[model samples]
Target: MTLNAAPRGLYFDDFEIGQEIVTSARTITLTDIVNFACLSGDFNEVHTNFEYCKTTAAGEPIAHGPLVYAVAAGLQYATGVNDGTLLALLQIDGWKMLSSVKHGDTIRLHSRVLEKKESSKGDRGVVTFLRQIIKHDGTTAQEMTAKYLYRRRPKA
Candidate 1:
């Protein structure tokens, strides 16, 4: 069996509380919505059926809540803050979808490290981050606090 080497990335000690990081923007598209619907089995009319959406309050198809959340999470990773140093996602707290994400809306994640603590064994640490998914127009589409466990750097 081949040994899996640890990926080089920021360790638990590298993070500073209150440090903010922004990610590259991505535009929501019909294909992305459709793909997310297929993958998640969430074929909601507001996200898939344009005709049905016309009769709704939004009057247009909106992206799925989970889709937006997933995208925001991906954007956070794209920022290279955690990278391969992430051990596991511990929890998600106070996740709120503040506004609808519609097709053609470019969005990005703005995240701040909220808290950090070492594990009992000191082999890893947990980091709590406050993340906001903001649209190009400056509207906050979603906000959440996510906790992740990151590995500590190995001692030489």
Candidate 2:
């Protein structure tokens, strides 16, 4: 967290180990894939061509792995949990693409706080969260651990 930033959302003091947050769902759209493909310059057939994908194990055009990751980040932001309290994303470690996300599959993010460490400087803290992207059918499509810098509670 920045020394001068004000806290408007969940500060480090408000978080506890094992706390969890669930986000609203969003359906993956073909538009999303196309836009992501265009944005990321990933024109791979598995994610862009259904006829070509029909020959793959997933059997159809599957969303790009990174696209689903971006959507998961959006879901977290939509929850308002990080509005102002989060300073920055320090790292994304142990990211795993457990399954494929297809067009029209509704998904939600399930995030659990794994750890919190108050900075030695005392103005900020570090927090790690385990996030899972869960499909409508209750399967996890992807998972990862993200570490973030966050503001501490302001002095009264």
Candidate 3:
């Protein structure tokens, strides 16, 4: 498959170690923060309180770290690289939030395949990806390495 084409969910053989995928951007909004707060029950003042956040370093409410991580995870799927071929998310490593994500910030994901190893049974492979959640101004807000299991395409 071509690099830029929409993958029909890649199989184990489709991933290359250095292949990179960029996803569409999503703007963070107050409603998103509020909804995430309600769903996650994370009501920290820095994330949910406008007046209270004015006294903090950011001077405005910031999105929750896990929320940003969740968005990044969704963005990876938006790329459609493993839409139908993914078996499971095996692990996450070295996840870090380097900068605060404030409301109105547009974010996108940049992911690169880091490693791939065939399973012992040979029906699937584990692929490791390094992902970055970047803001509109090119600031990296979060990063992590994720490992996913992908099925191998059946041989005819």
Candidate 4:
């Protein structure tokens, strides 16, 4: 990912329904898989054992699904659109892992604002988005509906 010199974040009031964001690409590597495996303690054969994978549908070791999901979130954050305006991740719904991403696959995040709602007290709001992880070959490897709490724009 290319580093941003000035990362701008959008407040709750700035998001509009139907708005889309496409982030820069990042390539998956064996080191990423190994690090994730060590961090998550999920050394599943599908992700850590290549020899064991030849017997499975993947035919070779693949990155963990959750690792890809995490990467997608990282890609979104790297865009700097939510630098400080984002308060917290409220929820994730309808998450799906449609395909497997392997080492060397370049991926990017596609995020679309689905809806936004103001808090009852007007101090914060929630934004719902449809986020997808798209691989270099144009395949959507994973997708989910993510709801995030965001602070409202500060009044002058």
Most lDDT-accurate candidate: 2
TM-score of each: 0.91, 0.94, 0.93, 0.93
lDDT of 3 by residue, 1-156 (tens): 656643489899999999998999999998889999999999999998889988999999999999998887788788778787999999989999999999999999998999999999899999999989999999999999999999998777
Top-TM-score structure, candidate number: 2
Q: For model 2, how does the per-residue alpha-carbon lDDT over 1-156 read when each residue is reduced to its tens digit? A: 658655458998898999999999999999999999999999999999989998999898899999998998899899888988889999999999998999999999999999999999898999999989999999999999999999988898
- Find the 10 residues in a row with the least total lDDT in model 2: 1-10
Poorest stretch of ten by lDDT in candidate 3: 1-10
Question: For all the candidates, what are their Cα RMSDs to the real structure?
Answer: 2.2, 3.4, 4.5, 4.3
Model 1 lDDT tens row, 94-149: 98989999999999999889999999998999989998999999999999898999
Clash counts for all predictions: 0, 0, 0, 0
Whose TM-score is higher: candidate 2's or candidate 3's?
A: 2
Model 4 clash pairs?
A: none
User: Could you give candidate 4's per-residue lDDT for residues 11-39 as a string of tens digits?
Assistant: 89989999999999999999999999999
lDDT of 3 at 17: 91
